[model samples]
Target: MRQRHKPWADEFLQENTHLIIPDPSNYKNKWHEVFENNNPIHVEIGTGKGQFIAGMAKQFPSINFIGIELAKSVIVSAAEKVQESEHANIRLINENAENLLDMFMTDEISTIYLNFSDPWPKNRHEKRRLTFHSFLKRYENVLKPDGELILKTDNRGLFEYSLVSFSNYGMTLQEVSLDLHALNDPENIMTEYEEKFSAKGQQIYRCKAVFPNQK
Candidate 1:
């Protein structure tokens, strides 16, 4: 789906740089300084409209949440929600996930969330998928030794592909849910897409995988 352009997106970002961090690469290993605490940092790579990240921040006050979104128009809405929530533990980054290594150091992140990411189903676009090997490599580098990656999607093909990808990467699957909503996990924070898809009777898939510790 094409993103609807917001004419005031630039202005909104300029005014709310605090909520949606500008030049996040500058933060690097200093994210704790940005949050003003040494709390564990959890990142949601495709933070659509800010619902999940904001909700997670409210749910886990001791953990710092950072949302990375590439779309200017979409991220502006996310920033608005973060602002309205008045949650100081949350921050937004208007940047691409491919640049994760540039913005964080080794073992800098505690957990990574991939929610309803673009499936990029074509064989030629396999590398573009967030679960692709290159992206997983990046995640492994930035994530702490004990850190785990959590993924949620309604797309079965993508879910299956990710399971294979994680296995090939030598990551251990901590948990797998074929029908996440059926489990009615109270701790589960639903993204806007998850809520919409679940309302339409679509089954949600979720998995948590941790990287093998380096010897």
Candidate 2:
């Protein structure tokens, strides 16, 4: 789907630099300094409209949340939500996930969330999928040894591909749910896309995978 351009996106980003960090690479391993606490950091890649990150921040006040989104227009909307919530533990990064290593150091992130990401189902575009091996390598590099990578998506193809990718990378699957909403998990924070899909009676797939100990 083509992105709808927002004319005020540039101004919004300029006015709210604190909420949507700029030159985030400078912070690298010092993310704790940004949140002013040593709390574990959790990141949501492709954080659309900030629903999941904002909800998670409100749900877990002790953990810092960083949302990485590449679309300026889309991220502006996310920043707006964070700004209104006034959640001190949440921050947004208007950057691409491919540059994760540039913005975080080894063991800097405790958990990573991939919520309703684009499937990129075509065989030719496999590498562009968030669960592709290249992206998993980046996640492994920044994530703590026991860091958990949680994924929630309505796309079964992507979910299945991710499971294989994780296992091939020697990651352990701690939990797998073919129908996440069927469990009625109270702790599950629904993203905007998840809400819409669930309303249509679509099943949600979720999995929590952790990397093997880095001996």
Against the true structure, whose lDDT is highest? 1
Candidate No. with top TM-score: 1
Which parts of model 1 are misplaced by more than 4 Å?
none
Give the per-residue Cα lDDT of candidate 1 at 92: 92
Q: For candidate 1, which ten residues in a row score worst on lDDT?
A: 206-215
Q: Report the number of backbone clashes for model 1.
A: 0
Cα-lDDT of candidate 1: 0.95
CA RMSD for every model? 0.8, 0.9
Q: How does candidate 2 fare on TM-score?
A: 0.98
* Deviation from native of the Cα of residue 171 in model 1, angstroms: 0.5
After superposing candidate 2, which stretches have Cα over 4 Å from the reference? none
lDDT of each: 0.95, 0.93
Task: Please give, for residues 11-115, the per-residue lDDT of candidate 2 as tens digits.
Answer: 988888888899999999999999999999999999999999999999999999999999998999898888888899998999989999999999999999999
lDDT of 1 by residue, 1-215 (tens): 78899999999989988888999999999999999999999999999999999999999999999999999989998988988899999999999999999999999999999999999999999999999999999999999999989999999999999999999999999999999988989999999999899999999999999999972
